[model samples]
Structure formats: structure tokens, C-alpha cells
Target: MAEEEEEKGGSKKKLFMIIGGVVALAAGGFFFMGGGEDEVMAEEMVEPEVVEGEVLDVGTMTIVLADDDPDKLRYVRVGLALVLDITADSSLVAGRVSLVQDAAITVISEMTSGELRGAVGAADARERLSTAAREIYPDGEVIRVVLTEMILQ
Candidate 1:
């Protein structure tokens, strides 16, 4: 009976130590990742954007997916928006919406379902679209490309 009680006590101590270690590690991680004053300091130290930016809704587009196997037909419908550097006149980017749309359709329609399914593929698509749009306006930069809606069928 005594040995059994000792065994139980040892196990309880081990459990407590394990719990304490986990708590300590979690607390350390939280503090390390800007959980306290570090977060406020980090935010305060960052600089703000110099150039104003604006979002342009590119709207929805449906592209027939390039499929390796012809037996199945697939399509992707995505809603895209562009963040562009703000200018005095809206025509800077607004005037080129048609060009952006044409570039997007031309690029996205060429990708197979397998090429557009994962996170990497999505990022690649964004980069390609951005490049295509930039090609339209060689002097201007598209700040960011947003894929608001992505439906794969």
C-alpha cells in the first residue's frame, strides 16, 4: 500500500511538473511574440505609407480551366480588386480597368485546375495578374491584388 501511494505521489509530481513546464513555455512564447509592451513598441516604431492608395474593384470573371483530361470540364469564377497608388485624377487606374480585365482573362484562362488549387498557385496567379496589369501601365505599380472571391468548379 505504501509503495502504491508513493507511485501515485510520483505520478502526481510528474504531472504537475509537466503542466508547469507547458505553462512556462506558453508564457515565454506569448511574451516573445509581442504579447505585452513589445507589441505596442513594435507598432509605434513602424512607419506609415508615404503614397496614398486606393482600391479598384475589378469585378468578377469566369474562365474555363485548362484541363489535361478532356473528359471533365471545369471552370473558375473569381472576383478581383486592385490596390493602386492614388493619384489626383481617378483616370490614372480607372481608365485602365478594361486593360486590366483583359489581361486577367488572358492569363487566368490558361492555367489548369491543378495549377490554381493551392496557396502557392493562388499567389502565382496574383503575381501573374499583377505583372500583366503592370505591363499595361509600365510606369505605374499596382500596390496589391486582392482575390475577393474564388470559386473552382
Candidate 2:
């Protein structure tokens, strides 16, 4: 009976050693793989600052869009403004305002009424106008394209 008791005690020690080893390995893995890397990365992330710039009015435009109905017509009237750096040369845009207006008209006139419906549509139009303006102006000349007023019908 003493030998039986010793054997049971020995088995308990082995079982405890195995559990301890597993716990140690799990702790080691967590420290090695899941350490403060995510926290460090989060700390390094930064948001861009919004810079206030000068506004240049590109004037209002009324564009006619082609519709499916032969007798009906669709149109959009949009007022635009261009944001430029404070020190940017206004003459560059003012001298070529007509060209910018033409580009705006071309872009807005191509879209159907449905494409210009929601906030997403307005954002898309703004992006397209910005791209078009960039093509006409040098880099950094036009900082952003602003839609002062937009009416889709």
C-alpha cells in the first residue's frame, strides 16, 4: 500500500509539471508575439492637418445633360470655388478661369441626374473636377475643388 501511494504521488508531480510547462509556453508566446507592437503602431499614426487656403470663384455654370426621353431635358447648375495656397499666384487661375469653367461643364454635363443624386455623387463630382483642374493648372496651383452650390434636375 505504501508503494501504491508513492506511485500515485509520482503521477501527480508529472501531471503538474506538464501543466506548468504549457502555461509557461503560453505566457512566453503572448509576450513574444502579442507584445506592445499594436500600441506602438497606434502611437505612430497621425492625422493630416487641414490647411486653410484662399478661395477663387470659378463662377456658376448651367449644364444640359442628355436624357433618355427625346422631348425632355435634364440640367445641372453648379457654383464652384477653387482653394489655393495663400501665397499662390491668383493670376494663373484668373487668366485661365474660362478653361477651368469649360472643364467643369464637360465633367458635370456628362453625368446623368441619378449619378449626381447623393453625397457620394457630389463627392465624386468634386474629385473629378479637381482632377480636371489639375490637368489645366500646374501641380499645387489648385489645392482643392469646392462646390459652392449645386442643383441637379
Question: Number of the top candidate by lDDT?
Answer: 2
Question: In model 2, what are the clashing residue pairs, if there are any?
Answer: none
Question: What's the TM for model 2?
Answer: 0.64
What lDDT score goes with residue 137 in model 2?
Answer: 81
Best by TM-score: 2
Candidate 1, 1-153: lDDT as tens digits: 999999999999999999999999999998788667877898899976747477789899998888877889889998998877665244567788888888888898899888999898899899998788778767565766778888889
Every model: Cα RMSD to truth:
12.7, 5.8
- At residue 104, what lDDT does model 1 achieve? 85
Query: All candidates' TM-scores?
Result: 0.62, 0.64
lDDT of 2 by residue, 34-112 (tens): 7888889887896545464779998998998755776778988999999886667887668888988999988988888
**What ranges in model 2 sit over 4 Å off?**
1-52
| Count of backbone clashes, every candidate in sequence | 0, 0
